[model samples]
Target: MNKLYQSYLGSFTGLRKEIWLLSLITLINRAGTMVIPFLSLYLTKSLDFSLEQVGWILSFFGLGSVTGSWIGGWLTDKIGHYRTMAISLIGSSLFFVLLQVPDTFWTICLGIYLVMCVADMFRPAVFVAISAYSKPQNRTRSVTLIRLAINLGFSAGPAVGGLIIAHIGYGGLFWVDGITCLIAGLLLLKLLHPKKSVEEVEAPITSSQSAFSDRSYLLFIFTMILFGFIFVQYFSTMPLFYAEVHQLDEFHIGLLMGLNGLIIFLFEMPLIKYLENTKLSALMNVILGFLLCGISFLLLNLTGWIGILIVGMLFLTIGEMIAFPFSNTFALSRSDGKKKGSYMALYSIAFSISHIFGHNSGMHLIGNFGFAFTWYIMLGLAIIGILLLLILRKKLEKETIEISR
Candidate 1:
């Protein structure tokens, strides 16, 4: 009993100062992002844009992200995390407010697209900062804190946005998001400045794809692409599955998202603590997350009840808990030297590619295959991912041992 109690306490108690700072960083950054949930709604309802135009605008967002991350990673290698992040935050905020400016279709698309890219730049810079801040020993803990902060921000955003929109209007959401970004950017610069300064100035972060000849890094990136493809269904496909096939309402849909965040917030610490020592094992966790995600679609088809959605969400959330921190830790471990910035950028590249494939494939699958068939197809994808990941088990174990040395 004492052991159990100690274990529980130990999970949250031993976090490093860096983890705390990163958590606050994420919370503040996400706090500023009231634009996410209401983005599509605002475009359609308030801006008088059609669904087709909204889709085009959203694609620009992704395109901007791809460009932003790629460029940001390069800049991080040349400059450093603190400066890169500060620039990204300040620059992105300017772009966010540009969304509210009335203009031609292409003009609005270009503006919003740039804002997305600025946001994307923050992704690798944030991860690379964590890698630089903590040694390999506690990298997973650092990442878990960031992930938790993002979810916390998500849970907080809707409630706040809903109330704010009630008073300020939808256009106000973009302006507020911009203001928060500016504030958060200043905070991040303050938070990430290294305490013990070496006399020699540090070189910036970098990521040359040709240099990624480190097979482990490449493999990890590839696997993440697959996992991301499967994981993205939560935001995209899951809602349609719930509403169209199961005949559920918006209330249940919102509740399911809330429950997923709550579950992750409550349990992510314990889960990451348990898995902190098991880096290579994260491959299996990611595979399992995909399987759960796959089966979640299947369950929705099988069980018509709203409770089934909760169950499916629980499975996906658990999978996320297991997979992400480990994957993050592994990615950073490879690029631990002077080239860490570039290395982290390579990791971001996988996610960008995965976003394109996942969103396109999800729509295609659900459209033609029908709901249940899509789930079955996703199940097959997960199983194949597991098999592919097993091939890397030996290499990952060796990597972990080397990091310890």
Candidate 2:
């Protein structure tokens, strides 16, 4: 048992202090992430919006995410990741508070769009920061460390958020979210001093090619969009499922949602370290991850028992653990120094685009057909994503062989 504990601890060794600081910042920011998880619920219950209307508002959120990612990427390259991240954190915090001012439908939609525009700018900048802070050999582990912080914060956020909502109401969520963002920004400024921390480590530039010109990478992005589309349902529609179908309340729903993050926080880093040592290709791991996610949804369809929800969440969490870090490493591997920001931006944009359709479409499917049908659709989409990834793997291998010749 002692040896096992030590082995697990070994996985986190050798990561730079800056990476740890960055992870701390992410934890602070995400721990207050009470709003997004509960956005659909607030819209439906508090404001009494229809699911369809909620879907449209979420789509606007996605649109803003796409815009933010583009601008963030551009700024990261232009002004550097430090400035970009600082601007995003401080700017988005103000917007989060402003979002509560708009109560009506159109105003709410516009509010969400604007909030996400400034908020999501943090994504690409952070990725660049991670790359700058870690060496190539340990990069994936660094990413996992950051993810662990994210999931840990997520685990705490929802449980606390549910309590906040129960006692004070959804209004409290926005204030907390905004305050946390402000704190994270200030912490970043103080702890991660730009002159000392920025550009500490430099990844090698293998190619000068633009991310848009990379066909195989584009295919990989498409696969990520599909995976994200299915995976994001956990946050959006799955909560509604718990409420309407399983008859769970907000507190229990928060507990269940928090389960995904808690599981990831406990197991993901060691799992990723284990996978990194194996001969399995990153793409192959990603394909397996997709399959597990699909099966997770299929498990939901297989039974009406509440235990099945936990079982399904376990599957989804494990799939997330396996897929996300490796996919991030793969994207970084394809990038060169000059366009690293652009490549990571495109990657962030893929998930952002998925948010646009994933939430709305799932809500529409559930509203029209029902949850069972939505699960089946999610499974089918995951299958399609797996197949696309398989194709991408073959193409990547062919390109490698041709280059060797």
Candidate 3:
């Protein structure tokens, strides 16, 4: 037990104190993440929205996210990460509160889109902050630590949010989520004071390179978009499928969803530590992650048993753990300090636009063919993502070797 404790402690030894505090902030913020998880249920049951309506409304949210990420990256480069993050967090909180206003369908839909746009602007800023604060050697673990904090908060949120929705209602969920975001923004202000002048963290041939002109980064983004298309279905469609097919209640569904967070919180740090110390490359980890995620969905078709759902969630959780952190490190490794924010913002579009392709398509598929067909389609996409990621990895490796020479 003593040796085991030491090993775990050692894994996180060299990470900066600022990163730890950032992780704490993420944990607090995500703990209140009650809105999105239950949004589908609220729309269908409470608003009496058709599947098509729900799909379009959610796709609008993604549209807003796409705009937000672009603006956030540009802001991070111009104004600096600290200010960008602060504004995004505080602005998003206000929007969440406004979202609770009683309104018509078009009004509510517009509100949802605006809320996501303000909130998602924080994504690129956070990535820039993480890269600025971390050592290149420790970058992967640093990113993983942030994710671990998010999952820890997520583990608590859904389970508690489930209870809140069941007893207090969806309005309560929005209010609590807003309050938490405000508090997190305040904490960021207190803890992290940005340097007056952004320090150049890495030297590059040119700081003026546009991400639009970078062919390698573009290919990587394309690969990420494919992966994102498969992954976002967990948020967009999986909850609906569970409710419809499995007949699970809100609390039970929350418990199952929370299970994904719990698994990541418990295992991701140590797993990343072990892998980083091995010969396994980021690209290979990505390939395996995609394969596992695909298989998780495929498992759904194989069993109607609830027991299989846990196994499936386990695979999905592990896949997220491996793919997401490494993907961040890989992108950062390819970028220099000057272009980091731009690179991260572009990277974020993979997830932002995926909300459209993944959710809208999944909903359409389920509406017509049923849940089995949706999983089958996701499985096929994951396989394609794996191949694309593999090719990207090889090209990236070649580029790095040439740069070294």
User: What TM-scores do the predictions have?
Assistant: 0.84, 0.98, 0.96
Looking at candidate 1, the ten consecutive residues that score lowest on lDDT are 196-205
Over 134-235, each residue of candidate 2 has an lDDT whose tens digit, in order, gives: 888888999999999999999999999999999999999999999999999999999997765535346556567889999999999999999999999999
Q: Which of candidates 2 and 3 is the stronger one according to TM-score? A: 2
Q: Give the C-alpha miss distance for residue 288 in model 1, angstroms.
A: 3.1
Pairs with backbone N, CA or C atoms under 3 Å apart (clashes), candidate 1: 76-205, 77-204, 77-205, 77-206, 206-342, 207-342
The TM-score of predicted model 1 comes to: 0.84
**How well is each residue in 240-317 modelled by candidate 1, as lDDT tens digits?**
666677775444554566566677777898888876556536566666665666666566667667688788888778
Question: lDDT of candidate 2 vs native?
Answer: 0.92
lDDT (Cα, 0-100) at 394 in candidate 1: 73
- List candidate 1 stretches off by more than 4 Å: 1-6, 38-56, 102-105, 162-169, 196-211, 242-252, 277-280, 364-370, 394-405
> Candidate 3 has what TM-score?
0.96
* RMSD, one per candidate, in order: 4.1, 1.2, 1.7
Name the regions of candidate 3 deviating beyond 4 angstroms.
196-199, 202-205, 397-405
Estimate every model's Cα lDDT from 0 to 1.
Answer: 0.71, 0.92, 0.86
